[model samples]
Target: MTGKSLADYQKEYERIIFFDQPKKDILLAGLKAEMEKQFKLPTRSKEWKNENQKVIAMYRKICITRML
Candidate 1:
C-alpha cells in the first residue's frame, strides 16, 4: 500500500465522520491536541512510529466502518 501522511488520513476520516462545521471544528481541535500530546517524542523514535501507525490504522478503520 502507498504511504499516506497522517494529515491526509485525518482529513479523509474527518470528511467521512463529521458533517457539522461547528462540531467538526471543535472535535477536530480536540483530537489534534491529543495527537500532539501523543506525538511529543522525536519523529524517528519507536514510540512515535508506533503512535503514528496506530493513528493511521484507526483512521482507516473508522473511515471504512463509517462508509459501510
Candidate 2:
C-alpha cells in the first residue's frame, strides 16, 4: 500500500470504468462532491483523506479483479 501509486490505480480504474476523458472527469467530480456531502468534511481534512484512501483501496481491488 505504501509503495503503490495512485497513478496505477487511476489508470486501472479508468480502464475498468470505460469512460472517455470528458465523461471520466465528470464522473470523478460527482464522486468527490458526493463524498464531501456525505462526510461533511473538507477534502483536505485528515478524516476525509483517510476515507478517500479506503475508497481507493476498495476500487483498486475491484480493478485488479476486473483486469484478471
Candidate 3:
C-alpha cells in the first residue's frame, strides 16, 4: 500500500488527475494497450476488467512515487 494512508492516496490521485488532464487519454490508452499485450487477456472478459483496474491503480501510485 506504499505505506501511505487512504487520504494521502486520494490527494495524490486528485493531483495527478488535475495536472495530467491533458495527457490522460493518451496515458490510459497506452497503459491499456500495454496491459493487453502483456497479459493477452480477452478484452470482454471480467478478468480483463479486474486486471486493468489493478494496473491503472498501480500506475497512479507509481506516478505519485515518481517511478514512471
Choose the strongest candidate by TM-score.
2
Candidate 1 RMSD to the real structure = 10.6
Q: CA shift at 1, candidate 3, in angstroms?
A: 25
* lDDT (C-alpha) at residue 17 in model 1: 56
Question: lDDT (0-100) at residue 2 of candidate 1?
Answer: 45
> Can you write out model 3's per-residue Cα lDDT over 1-68, one digit (the tens) per residue?
23444345455455555446557545544544444455453356776667567554655554554443
lDDT of model 1 at position 26: 58
> lDDT scores for all predictions?
0.55, 0.53, 0.51
The candidate maximizing lDDT is 1
Residues 1-68, model 2: lDDT tens digits = 14334565456455646776566656655554444455443545776567687654644454344444
Clashes of each: 0, 0, 0
Candidate 2: where are CA atoms >4 Å away?
1-16, 43-68
- TM-scores of all predicted structures: 0.37, 0.41, 0.35
Residue 44 alpha-carbon offset, candidate 2, angstroms: 6.4
**lDDT minimum window of 10 residues, candidate 2:** 1-10
| Best-to-worst ranking by TM-score | 2, 1, 3
lDDT of predicted model 3: 0.51
Error of 2 at 66 (Å): 20
lDDT of 1 at 25: 52
